[model samples]
Structures are given as C-alpha cells and as structure tokens.
Target: MPRKLLILIADGMGDYPAQELDGRTPLQAARTPNMDAAAAQGTVGTCRTIPSGMPAGSDIANMAIMGYAPKRYHTGRGPIEAAAQGLDCAPSDLIYRLNLCTVSELSPSGLMLDHSGGHIQNEEALNLLQVLRTELDTDQVQIIPGFQYRHLLKHTDGVGTLEAGLDLVPPHDILNTPLAPALEVYARSPLLDSMIHRAHSILTSAWNQTQANAIWPWGQGPPLALPSFAHTFGLRGAVISAVDLIKGLGRAAGMDVLDVPGATGLVDTNYQGKVQAALNFLEHGDFVFVHLEGPDECGHAGDLDCKIQAIERFDEHIVGPVMLDLARMEGAVCMACDHLTPVGVRTHTTEPVPFCFLDSRQIQSGAHEGFSEAAAAAGDVHLEAGHLLLPYLLDRMQEADG
Candidate 1:
C-alpha cells in the first residue's frame, strides 16, 4: 500500500491573544472541530517557518514549508511570482512585486491608507495597469497586470545599477504609517521614484473613481531557480493556491500548479473548488499542498470576525472533508500555518506556528485538546527549523507504514 501526503496550509493563521476574542487567538476562538480531532488523535507542535533575520512574508515561510530552505534557495518575492506567471527573464533583469495602493496624499507626510487599494476589483485594476503600461512601457521598464491590486514591474536594465543594496519596504507593513520614509527609500532609485510619482499622477488624473491612486514596487530580485521537488523528495507533488507567490514557488520547484475557479485570495474565496482540486490532484500525486489565503488577508485587514470565519471555513469546508477521505486510505495529513499575522499588528510576524500531523494508519493518543497555539505548545514536538517539517512528516509516515 502506498501512503500519500497532504499538507493543508492556512496562511498567516497564527496570531497573538486578542481582546476581541477575550485574550484568545482566532484559532483558539474559532470552531475547529476537525483540527481539534487531528491534534487530539495525532501529534501537535510548533514550527518556526520564518528563519531568524528574514522578513516574515508568505514567500519565505511557504518556501520553507514546501521543504526548501529559504536562506539557501530564496531569491525574492518578485522572482518567485514571475516564475508563477511563466515570465521569462534574464539573470540580469530586475523583477519587482508591484502593488496598486491608496495613499492619503503624495507628499512626504501622507499616509498609506490602503496597501491593497481597498481591494480594487480585477477589471478596474487591469484597466489602470493597461493605462500605465501604455504610458510607462519602455525598453528598460515594463508594467504587468496581475490579480486585483497585485501587479509586477520589470526593469530590463537594472542589474548592476539598481539591484545593489536597495531597500524598498512592503506597503502592507506600513499600513496607516507616514509615507515619508518609504518615499525616501524609493527616491534612492531615481528610475523607481520617477515611475512611482508618474504613476500616481496618471492614476489620479485618469481613474478617480477607485481607491487605487498609486503604484508601489518592492521585493526585487533576479530570476529564481530551484531543484526539482520530485527529485529532492521522491514524491510527485502538486500545489493548489489562489495567489501567485505560492504557485510561483511550486512552479520553480517543478511541481504541478493547480488553479481553481473563483479562488479569490479573500474571505469569499471558493473553498469547495480548492478542496476538489486538492482531492483530484491526490488521485495521481503523491503529495498535495493546499494553501488558503483568506485568513492572511483578513489578518492584514485587522478583521477579527472575518479571520475567525475564515478559519472555521477552512476547517469545515477543506480540512474536515479532506481528512475524512484521507482517513479511509493509507495516507498522512499535516495542517499548519506559515506564520503569525496577528490582527493587532495587522502584518506578518516571525513566530513559531502551530501544526498537527496525523497518520491514518496509526492514530496516537495525544493529550492535546484542540489545534491552537497554546495547545500545540503544550504538546511534545517542536521543530525550530521549519524546512525540516516536510521531511519529518514523511519520515513519520514511512515509519508508520513499516
């Protein structure tokens, strides 16, 4: 009998104690009977997905969870996403993750009102990007449209000139903060500064109906290359995600990327579609990574109710159903979050995230009450290096099978 592996990742689902939840994290407060059962009948612990000194972003944490050490393989968030889009780029070309954002003003003292431009609709966002592309597209610079407020910028001539020691901050990190420091950082790159300012001018003048008033670019790097996942792990793997970053990492690792319709990276995402996609992939793949972005987006918005709802939906619509099916077969399931995106901070943090591993063949009598930060910490296992998690789970599954 062949044992399969299923990794369910609720992105940025970990969090600190919140007053709204009466000092309980969203995971603790949410109704997660499926996750609870996994913890109680399996092994629960904490894993530090984000390496020390690394920015607590999904790009780094997810790569670690997928069995690749970020310090060894990570190039940048932009290049990973570029790979997801199947964009060809030279080693010298500079790629950046661009965002259509909303600012209170364009001056130094202006505030970053919305990092996602109020979650601008796709049609409107594409129109804005098209206009910018028409005006700003040059031999050296190009603007590429992505989903919603997320986009991309490529600087074909920025290898030696604009790639060294450049510091561009992620807009989500500076939510509600003054834009002076970020603007100052952008000013370091004359080309980026001019382009950003020109983008603001054009967007405000052309599309005044939407909150997307400016373009912010960060996370620049060269083309990314990674060893094949199948070769590294000896498992045919597939990734199901709504966002490009995860898809990009899967693509870079030579894993099949599965797309589900209506899979918005929001609270209203297609839960059933993702579950179906993961189940279908598992029929032929040895390993399947199912990633949900709703929790992270709600955390970024500082919406406690929405975050809790997202967690519940993940458990009920995805985890519960998938776990039921896997339990009927000889397989193993691991449920975890990439990092902590506390509603209080409204951004990602480098903290150990809770996880539970359940082998259908050998369910253990664990003392864990449910799957939460506190419960997982109370359990016995703890992995300081998150990149080892996949290998650890596989080893445990193999031992159980033997």
Candidate 2:
C-alpha cells in the first residue's frame, strides 16, 4: 500500500487563543494525547501559505499548501469552490464565491456596521440565491446557491478565465488582505452595476423584507485551475472546509470534500464525525484534508473563550486522533493554519503562522508540547506565510518516496 498523508487544516488555528488560558492555546491546552504522541514521532516545523510581500486569500493560501505557486498556477474562484462542493468545472464556465451581505446605505460607512447581514444561515442564503437566479433575465450568466455565505454565478462563455480580481475592501480588507481599490473601479463600470442590480432586484422581491433581504454579492470572478496537494505530493487528496474559498481551492485543484453534518461554521462545531471521517478516508486514500472553520469563526466573532475551545477541539479531537491513526497506518500527518485570525482584530492577520508535523518513522517519540504558535515562540521553528509549508510538505513526501 502507498504511504498515506493526513493534512489537518484548522481554519484560523494559531497560537494566540492559548494566551487566555495560562499561555496554552487550544492546541496546547487541550488533551491531545494522540496528536502530542504523533508530534513526538515526527518532525514538527512551520511553513508559509502566504509568502512575504504578497497579498493572500484562503484560496491562494491553500493552493500554496498543496504546492502550487500562485503566479504560475492561478485560476478563478468558481472552479476552486465547485471542487469542494463536489461540482467539477468543465473548464469553460467561470466560478465565483458569493456573499449574502446586506446592501445597506453607504451612509454610515463605518466598518463595524457595514457588514450588517453577518453569516446568514444556509436556508436563507439559498432562498435569496434562488430568487436572484430566476430574476436576472438579461445576462447570459446563471446564478446558483452554495453555502451560507457562498453561491455560484456561472457565465456560459467557455473558459473565460476570469481573474479572482477581488479588490482590497470589506471581506478582503475588512476581514483580511486589504491592498487594492478594485471595487471602486469595478463599481463605476456598468458591468458592476448590472451585477449588483440583478441581486438587488431579487432581494427587494415580494418575499424579502428590504432591510435585511437586500443581499449584496461580491468577489466576482471565474473558476480557477491551479495545481493541488495531490498533484504536488502524489497523494490522493480531499479538503474539508466551511470557507467556500478553501473548498473552492480544493475544487480547482481536483480534490473532493468530506461531508460533515451540523457544521454550523460557529464556535460550536461538529467534531466527532470530522475526526472519524478523516481516519476512515486515510485508511483508504493517501491524503485527507480536514478544514475546521470554527476557530476562524470564533476569531471573527471575537469570542476568546469560544476561540480557545475551537482550537481545543482540534488538539483534543481532530489532530490528536489523526496522529494516532497515522501511527497505526505508518503514515505522516501535518497541522497548520492558513492565516492568523487574531481575536484582537477579529480579522485575518498578515503575521506568519507556525506548522507542526508528525510521523512515526521520522521521530520515534510521536508527540511534543511546543510545536504550534502558542509554544512555537518557545519551540525551535518559526515559519512565515502559509505557502512555505508546501515546499517542506513536498520535501517530506519525496523523502518517503525515497
């Protein structure tokens, strides 16, 4: 049998949450006996998903983690997300991650209240997407529903190669990487107005109440075709994430999603199933990616306790057990976060996150305490960018091959 690889991608899992609890992050504080054991056996180090002097998104960050350089292997967002949803793109249609945001008056202009809609449920987002799809009569494009904050607008233009040309604002800027003024330029363009108009018309429908129903869609672009974790490391890979962006990245790179029921994308997550599914899949395949979204969610919520618990879930339930199973299968397991979603800012930080690896063959002990961010400052490695992890991960796989 081929050597198995288990990649546990905890969305927004970093070192800070541990500070509230006597300097132990959720990963550090939680009882991750299995994970600590794995760390003891393997070489735990850090890598960068978003390299130095580059603007990054979870899409690109994950792409780098899977070993694809953004400059050479970048595609649109639609195809990337489609893959995570299990919808493979045809290379002709474009893919974009949709947001069910409130189209409030720009009068207030304050960052705190502009994003008033805030994490609408899947049922509600789907309802709005359906109405918008049926109402947009003019464009040759078609809109479809995705997750809570995501949807798809596929234009029938055949490999249009739309750029993930997202501007540095709100979600990117307010929530994460803020470095451009694309939205202003795009807003002035007639095309942007039409896109917004179509969505506005649907939200102001008979069913929706204008106040909250005025859902605004952003991050317009096409399906991307980037190389992925499987291609880079020669492993059969799949990504499990609540972030449509990461799910989309997995899709663009030819990967599958591991479904978990009751995944609310809040601090309270479905942990038991996620852990078991990961082990079950690794037993059969070479790679299995588990993306837990709660930590990021909690960070965005600015709930320190919730955030700590989210990380604790990973250490106690997810990564910890994954390491144990890998030990049995003689496999390698790696843990890392795409970005720093510090509760201080309650948004993604440019700060580089640490990474830890576990493999029985490399380190016979199989567990350690100071490998993640909380303890990384005290540990041996401090890596920057989520991308750097790729080369290290690829290197590890190549060594296994040798």
Candidate 3:
C-alpha cells in the first residue's frame, strides 16, 4: 500500500526566449494542454540540476536528478554509457565516448565538422565501429558499438584512479572548432595518441562512403559503482529512456531498464512506445522515471520548429496518455527537465530548469496555468539543488496505506 510515483523527464525541455517566437521559449509556445493541466493543479518551480562549473552533460545532470549527488557518483559519461551497453570494465580501464564524427581533416588535429555525423543510422554506425575495431582495437583496447553516432572505446590498464583524470572535451561542445587542442590530452598516452592518428587514416579513406570520417574520443573514466535506488529511496523503480546514459543511470541505480521497440532517441522517436512502456512499468513498480530525448536533440540541432514540434509531440503522445492512465491510479506524478539546452547556444546550460509535481488524490489550486520556463520561474517551491528535488517530490505523494 505504499504510494506510487511517476517521474517524467523531457530532456532539455527548458529554453530561452526565441526572437522569432516573440520572446517565447519552445515550451511556452508549444500546445501542451496535458502538461499545462498538470502545472495548473500541481506545485511548480525551477531547480538547478547541474552543479556549477560542471560539464553540463546529461550524465552529470541526470545523476543529480536521480538523487545521486553528481559530485560524488559521477565518474564520467563514458563509464555510464559503458554500463548501459553491458560492457564489463576493470577499475583500471579507460572508457571513452567514441562518436562517429565528421571532420574536415584526418591529420594530428582537424576541424570537427559534426558530432553526430548527420545522425547516422545504427546499422551504418555499427559497420563503421566494426571497421574501427579491426583497425584500432588491440589486446589492450576494445571498440563497442552503440545506437546512432554514440559508441564506446575502452583501453584496459589505462584508467586507474590516477589515470582517469584525463581532461577530455565532449565533441558536441566544440562544434566547428579545431580538434587539435582537444586531441592533445591523449598525447600523455602514446598508445591512445597513435590510435587516434591511425583511426583518422582509416576514417579518411572511408569518408566518401560513410560521411563519418573520424572517431572523437571524450568522457574518459574508470569503472564506477552507485547506490541502488531501492536502497536509497525505499521504492522499486523502473526507468524508460532511449539514451544509453539514462539507461546506464537506471542500471547504476538498480532500477529496471526497459527497452521499447522503435525508440530512436531523436526528433522522430517512438513517443507512443515510450508512453506505453512507462504504463507497463508503473503497473507493478513503486516508481517509474520516464525520459524522452527528442526535445534535447532538436535543441542541440538548433532547429526551432523541430524543437517546438518535439515538445508538442511529447505532450500529445507521451505526457497526455500517461496522465490519462495515471488518473485511474492512486499515485503522484512529477515532470521536469534535467537541464537547459538552449537552441541559441546549441549546448547544455547550468541554469536552473523547472519542474512540477502533483498528488493524485488532492490537486492543489493556485498552481501555474502551464508548465514552461517562465511559468515555473514565477511559481514557488524552488529547490536549490536538483538532487534534493526527488526526495521533495516523493514527500508530496498521497499515501495509499494511510
């Protein structure tokens, strides 16, 4: 008879005012009747998920949102993604995010053209990763394939606690920037440096056919361990996300990581499938954390219309349906973004993003009319740190056992 909870995360849903939209953020402009209804009947406010001066990557931000202090638990995005791919790593293994990127050159330093390499398909990406493995992988290294442009490269015996401190930069953060400065970090390790150079040679030859000419390695870290969600929060939890990082978070938290067919983690992802997955998990789980990556993808692409469309689609296909299903259950619901991925910057911001939570049995009045950056800013109930918000959210639930 424990109270149930639903946590919905629209990745990078927060944004700044758009000049073309008359100063309205995408969420402010989207037709989110369902989210609006939740905001109007719930407690809404802003919360800073990413700690100050952090990389602002989804890995760090989401760790905070999931109630694990990023400062303590976060090793790097690479290790989390490795966990999601079910890749076993020793404590001394150096894990990196191997993105199939487009570069202008294959020299020691080149211009990073596209982090996603036109959002290459999974089949093609896998093929390219295999080629990399053949050309680069040795007894000391392993190349693992993941969805779309995301992949992994692991260097065994290269990431002891001391070696894990490599200051690598995420390729997405340096779009249109030179790669030399970033590549210099690997120079410390002769093997890794040579691998990058050789990988470039192999990629340059295949550029004409693949559009992906290079593998950008970043987010290096050693193996990691996290406290289980059940142990920390006293709830059996499940997580639904198309992205490996979120799935990794779920696995680290000892939550059920569900895989929904047709989930692409893009603007055209399987929204309905995710909603259904959430429903299925919530049927027996004490908590369900649902995450969608479409809005964040569009924001990173700087496509205003697509971002708005993604937000609208999330409302119609995911939020609306889940809310309807939750209506018949005795549970509480909460919705929020992990961090702000402003379309202008085309990257994650450390600003405080907004959130809204409501009790199913007693809907509070005087709540904001809708969920948006502006609306949440005006409302009360701000949490200074994002990790604290989850516990606060659970405290609002109406107890069925009572």
TM-score of each: 0.98, 0.80, 0.95
Residue 329 alpha-carbon offset, candidate 1, angstroms: 2.8
Candidate lDDT scores, in order, read 0.90, 0.61, 0.83
Residue 116 in candidate 2, Cα distance off native in Å = 8.9
The most accurate candidate by TM-score is 1
In model 3, residue pairs whose N, Cα or C atoms come closer than 3 Å (at least 3 residues apart or on different chains), thus clashing, are none
Give the CA lDDT, 0 to 100, for residue 95 in model 1.
89
Please give the range of 10 consecutive residues that has the lowest summed lDDT in model 1: 157-166
C-alpha lDDT (0 to 100) for residue 122 of candidate 2: 70
> Per-residue lDDT tens digits of candidate 2, residues 195-215?
755566666567774343443
lDDT of 3 by residue, 98-163 (tens): 888888885545677778877889888887887788878888878888889998888788765444
Model 2 CA lDDT for position 95: 54
TM-score between model 1 and native: 0.98
lDDT of 1 by residue, 1-402 (tens): 345899999998999998877899999999999999999899999999999989998999999999999999987888899999999899898889999999999779999988899999999899888889998889998987888988889989576775445888899999998999999988888888899999999988944689999999999888889999999999999999989999999999999999899999887889999988888877778999999999999999999999999999999998999888987557889999999999999999998999999889878775578899998888788999889999999889878878
Model 3 misplaced regions, further than 4 Å: 106-110, 161-163, 206-208, 398-402
- Of candidates 3 and 1, the better by TM-score: 1
